[model samples]
Target: MSERTKTRRTRGVLGGRSERVVLEVLGATVAELAESGYRAFRMDAVSATAAVNKTTIYRRWPGKALLVGAAVEWMRTFVHDVPLPDTGSLERDLIDAFRRRLGIKERVEGRAWARLLAEKNDPEVDSIIGAAVEERSGAWYAMVTRAVARGELPDGTDPRLLLGMLGAIVDAWNAKSPGRLKADLLEAAVRTVVAGARSGSLVRSPRRRPAPRAG
Candidate 1:
């Protein structure tokens, strides 16, 4: 978090016209990954979409693993960089966060992008995906914890379970009715989950630590 480290990261991630190229290429990389997947993804197609020379891409990222890993990390960074909503109400915050998340997903060819994650690729690619997903999960956990901290949620409300239930309900709702998420539907999901949480239905007991073995 020091200035030097921050500057170094900034330089590696973005700067000047290079920033634009990085974003465009990363976007195209995602789009390409969705369409062709990692095994079949090609730098030529990425260059065409990004309108940058293949050599240009190679100059920045010498290998496909590096480039694709960067693209995967870009998806995580794109989500992480956004400000989390704090609407002072847990329901409102959840709804707003879900809306923002969906918007980002749609912008990046979300369904295809998600499918790409399930495909078998290099171990390095898998590692990158795992790390990105772990960090993204933290964002959801933060949203839940903030609600609890603000007294909108009761003590012992399991953040993971609460978020999981909400997501599951929304996903089920989407499956039943194939369309963009309606405001009423989102409100209902948030209401149902929040009510359950408030009633202690979503409360989880703390896990007990195991006793030490012979040492």
Candidate 2:
């Protein structure tokens, strides 16, 4: 068999149109909700935007927050599938990972997600957001931990804080009007964060410091 045929067969293992439709609807609902304030956003509006019937919407999602929750989860979940390339260099891996995430955040759907996140205040919304955060963070943490294990990061490096730094760069990019988180910007931010992490790790541990240099 041809290599192309082999590759095609391997790539077809993921899923089908039904999955994409659900994810697309979830993303569309988020955009519609963001464009139209929560008070003005109704199930009918979501159903229409999602191109699914009210029955379908209700059947899949009991309510608006539930639907939005799914979309929020999907947005964060996208980052999980983008496995960082094993480039053997910390800077390259970090930059590539950030760039992969940045490309998603720069899109129209991503801006809508950012808007939804900014306006979130309801308790139900908070709960869903928390769950999404936990799910995606778990995945990213594993990737960073691997880097640390490979000595790409400091032994004592805080994965949580490092992840926060990466998240903040995208958040800031999304904060701008007509926001565009370009790859170049992502690369720069990754370089800076990696530099700081390396510098902090090189600092002599306070507990390990010699007593006053015997002055």
Candidate 3:
């Protein structure tokens, strides 16, 4: 082969190897996160687990935050892309979504997520969590918009606030009790929120002016 052709082939081989190494490191990162959470996750541990040199990981990710962020993004995109189910009823759909969110605590990955949420001082990790929350909020907003169009929800429902409430409820439950969540309790909470939304109680009402006669 010509010198240029040889160089091209060499580059192709090296590119394939680099891609494989990145994948391995990311996979190992996920495993580390799942096994030890972010507080305990270490580059040396990941290097040992992935059988890749620590320098390789650093060269690609630069730091723990970037590596963890990339691992989380990959997991969210490929491994666990949880979607909000649309089953006609807004209550049912929200209950299903919340249920899935609550169920995360039952798995290793879920525990890792919980740990990350609890200890999110790192700016990069916080950014990753913010992005994930935005993505999930968008999905929930789409679901709520559909419900509004179908007359199940009030016209001016705040999807972000509603989602935040639901998330807070689940997070509180997880923090208080770390095992399997009670389905009935979750269902009840979701039903209550949905009822409030339907009745406009959850929406912020406009401020009223005092009567002029009072002056």
lDDT by candidate, in order shown: 0.77, 0.66, 0.76
Ranking by lDDT: 1, 3, 2
lDDT, candidate 3, 1-215, per-residue tens: 89999988877855687768877888888778877778788788899988999987888789888898888887687425766799998888888877776666676567667677776776656777777856766887898889888977766677777777877887687678766578887888888888777766555447332222211
RMSD of each: 7.3, 7.5, 6.4
State the lDDT at 201 in candidate 2.
41
Candidate 3: worst 10 consecutive residues by lDDT?
Answer: 206-215
Residue 137 accuracy (lDDT) in model 3: 62
Taking all chains together, the TM-score of candidate 3 against the true structure is 0.73
Q: lDDT score, residue 84, model 2?
A: 57
Say which candidate scores most in lDDT. 1
Best by TM-score: 1
- What TM-score does candidate 1 reach? 0.74
Cα lDDT of candidate 2 equals: 0.66
Q: For model 3, which pairs clash?
A: none
TM-score of each: 0.74, 0.63, 0.73
- Misplaced by over 4 Å in model 2 are 1-27, 36-40, 50-56, 70-80, 84-86, 119-121, 169-185, 201-215
lDDT of 1 by residue, 1-215 (tens): 99999999898878878899998998899888878887787889999999999999999999888998888667665566567787788888899987776665556556545655666466765665776666667877888888878877776678899988888887777667645888898898899889877766666656443222222
Error of 3 at 69 (Å): 3.1
